[model samples]
Target: MTYFPKLLTICILACILGATTFFYVKKSVYIFDTNYFKINSVSRAALKETGSKQCKNCSEGVPNLIIQYGVGRTATTLQFQILCLMMAFLHEDEINDVGCYYNRRNLVKKYNVIKCHDISWYLTVKWSKWVFMTSNHALLSRRLNYMRGKIKDKNTTIPFIADIDLVSRRGHYIVHEYQRFFGISDEKMQHIVEYLRYWDVLRVCCGMQMSADWRNHLAPKAKYKQHHSYHSPTYPACEMYNISQVEHLLVNTYVFKKLSHIGSLRDVIGKTSTVDGILNGSYCERCNTNISKMHLKFNQNCA
Candidate 1:
């Protein structure tokens, strides 16, 4: 009887060890799934085809497709919340495909938005001195700029609903920062100024809320000028503009269509719609000039 009990104990221990090893190995490996890329989804394929055709007029490269899958009905909202959570925990790394996949699968449904906001707030309170320092700001800005360039080049736009959530989160961060510094006195006015400043920073770093007229006009002209009457748009240029327009349309379809959304707005305006144009030139003359001045002022302040 004693021998049987000892054998049972050994077997149980072996099983426990085996299970732990399996989990450790599983956690260590990063796997990419076709579902993550929406490879088998019709919606993803269609979006890719449309995006590729549209981006061909731009000078930069674009992703062949923009894919959206679901973690449930609330996937978009959950995804945004998860992004905020990961940014809080992971410290803004390169955001590789594998990292994105793992983070999405692991965290999306596990945390609610309110929970995420609390965790993020806790992190900011505990780590703000380390995280939100001026030196870190430059690093964060560069990382965001790099990500923006990658998205622009791939011609892949994030989903509009998700973008809205990101904008909202950014706005919240701005207000939070103001409250930390300014307190409750004049809170309302400070909130508005902070919101505008937040948006301005987003426009500069994230390429949010772009005008479609720039893509329609400037992209084609840049293509033509670069290729010297290449006559028809090339694949890359077509893909870039297509992605750009679709992204812009997703955010503002009616506004995009009303702005003479056509081929090559730049030729008419006498300019080029390179990545710089897409980033800085897509706005109307007034907004563009204002953004430029703000950029100058920002640089001066940084200096």
Candidate 2:
């Protein structure tokens, strides 16, 4: 009789702990169903974290088709809204594609206008990006473990936008926006940030995918440049990066974009003249002086 009472007490404590954790996750984290998530066709009510149909198999190919952006201050809100609206263009199958596929469209609407999508669609994209990134079994398992099945899918793509935002500092702004849009308490917002940072969806490295740093390790410097296009809009900004030690391109995007402006380029281009000369000629040399003027001259000669 004495042993039975002790066993019953232990069982009751275990049940209480389990119940507490279940409810905690239920209130804390949310995951979305990327399969049905589209930015354009949104029903905010559909995005509840019901704990059913949460895990699915990821696509087999490498995720080489992701649309990356640094999310600048001037363009942060506008870019997010634009991408959310653009999600409507994504095919159902593409939602879970490891290649991170999504369609792009013209920025036709007035950016300043407040539409329902500004909030709902923004959250939808956030969830979708994370879902695609976590398509892998191990990473998906890790994500589920972290969220504790309390994840909110928003049934749209809210987690996705938040996932990409995790890869950059600008993600802070997006989190704040989420709080304002949803009336999330400050404590809840901070809790969400902690969870996203701890799991790090952006840094979910795998054999099929690695960042520019790993690529440099495996391939020659020249090959790395060629593979990623040194002419990328963010190229000039990347030039200042200590590529020898850099690990994550997604992480560096916002850093370089913020650090290297026209004025900053002037210092860089001028210093190049003192060395072997990266530009070979005066194109980048005078880049700081008049990029538009030099660009026109080069284009005219080519024509």
Candidate 3:
């Protein structure tokens, strides 16, 4: 009887240990489903026909296919809406806001937009250009760990990795700093000032009279909070950031160290210019200049 009881106790302990190990490993890795990419018909066909993971003969005019891989808690929805509006203004079509996949109608379609959140999907797929959106580590961790009630861990815990190194060197990628969205401007610094002015007016007008869903999904009441459960059209203003926390994340994390290898916008475009300047928008020459001039015009309907 004693032996049996001891054996039973051992078995229970083993099971408990196994379960703990499983949960720990699972939490450490990013969890996603097969449909995460939602690869559309056009991309599916392209992959099948080419038997390669690269878009051939891509140029700057209108990308054959553009993948916007916005990191979680990184103002993805905001960027998506902004890009969609810009596309509409430019008369472009076939933008899928959910996942990074699109079907082109014809040659005149110019380009298609697909928002991809899966880092795994981004690493495996092929596309003409990638618009990578992310924020500093401090802000990303805070939002990811946000809960209305009690906290789980005493110290900061990062369940997923959003390092810049995951970006593939085989293709073209543009790392757009999320912080810049707040004070977005060009070399001259006028578009975003005007854009923010319009954004403020829309926020007030819709904030007072909008439906519950509209208010929750479109505009966040708090500056630090995200616009929606999923994505936001704009990041909180620069004033909302915790400067001390931002500095802490920068100094403590190795992720930001990888960015040092990436050349700043002012630096001569060379092999090291693997990505557009990530740490600050002031260093991002292309984004500050081209993006302002070529794209990003205000649209009334988005409100």
Candidate 4:
């Protein structure tokens, strides 16, 4: 049970939604079996009549948890970066001009079009905060020397960074490369990686899903695609069970709440995955009872 397939599921869903966007690509959105998701209340748009249609100052009046305070993500977070930035835009974070550190900063054209050209977010604490929160390496590298100075002067809190293992791992090579390329000191880099806080991608995915309920904004012209590896359990599971259509793309309130606390999608293999790719918990609350039912349904689908 690895996090690989769960991410694939998300990628698939993103491609499904991408089909409607301006940048379209040929792809299949594998709609998994949802006999387990016996959600009676149909998922509906849960938007608020908050003032201007735009988020003038994203951080200004956002209720707690409006934008997730993620921590300790690595280079393996490429796809999640797209989703995170997209989520941030929905929340009205001024990121159009903020070059995304996807493999390289300010590299992606879509995000480039999103920038506030000529304007720089480099001076703001929000920009620094987001870089640290989401572990945006590009901006962090450019600002690291200044950021360390800020911490010394008590100007800002320390941002999370990756450690030796997490950064150097196979899908995480970029962390090291970026750090070396930026000439970050061993001591500072070590501290960034060792700091406490583990915002798992699986958990982030679920959080993003919650954001999806209200923060449904998206790019109309960005091309989207799904990627899955040979080791992805979800691929095999899909092949075996073969769910043709997904009734509701949304996870209900109960499952949503349940996923918030105890999801281990990062650890779960892909086959017979949950809608949110949430891992089934050992303890069964009413919500988890539904998860149990979901597992049963998935097994039944395969049977």
**Clash count in backbone of candidate 4:** 14
Each model's total of backbone clashes: 23, 26, 2, 14
- What tens-digit string does per-residue lDDT give for candidate 3 at 1-303? 689999999999999999999998876663443333342332333224322222232122333334444454343433443433233223312322111122222223344445555534433334443343433344334542242011122221111222322222211112222223222224212322233233322222222222233333333345444443434333333233332344333323332332123222112111111121222322223322332344322221121
Q: lDDT values of the candidates?
A: 0.30, 0.30, 0.32, 0.28
Instruction: Please give the lDDT score at residue 289 for candidate 4.
Output: 36
Local accuracy of candidate 2 as per-residue lDDT tens digits, 42-92? 222222331122222222221222232321222232233322222212221
Name the candidate, 3 or 4, with the larger TM-score value.
3
Q: Per-residue lDDT for 72-174 in model 4, tens only?
A: 2333243233223232333334433223222222333222211111112332323222223233444344543444454435333322333223333433223
True lDDT of residue 61, candidate 2: 20
Worst lDDT run of 10 residues, candidate 4, spans: 40-49
* Residue 2 displacement (Å), model 4: 77
Candidate 2 local lDDT, residue 80: 33
Global lDDT for candidate 4?
0.28
* Model 2 stretches astray by more than 4 angstroms: 1-169, 201-209, 218-222, 226-303
**Cα error, candidate 2, residue 93 (Å):** 29
Give the TM-score of each candidate: 0.21, 0.22, 0.27, 0.21
- Locate the minimum summed-lDDT window of 10 residues in model 2: 267-276
lDDT of 2: 0.30
* Winning candidate number (lDDT): 3
In candidate 1, which residue ranges exceed 4 Å CA deviation?
A: 1-168, 184-303
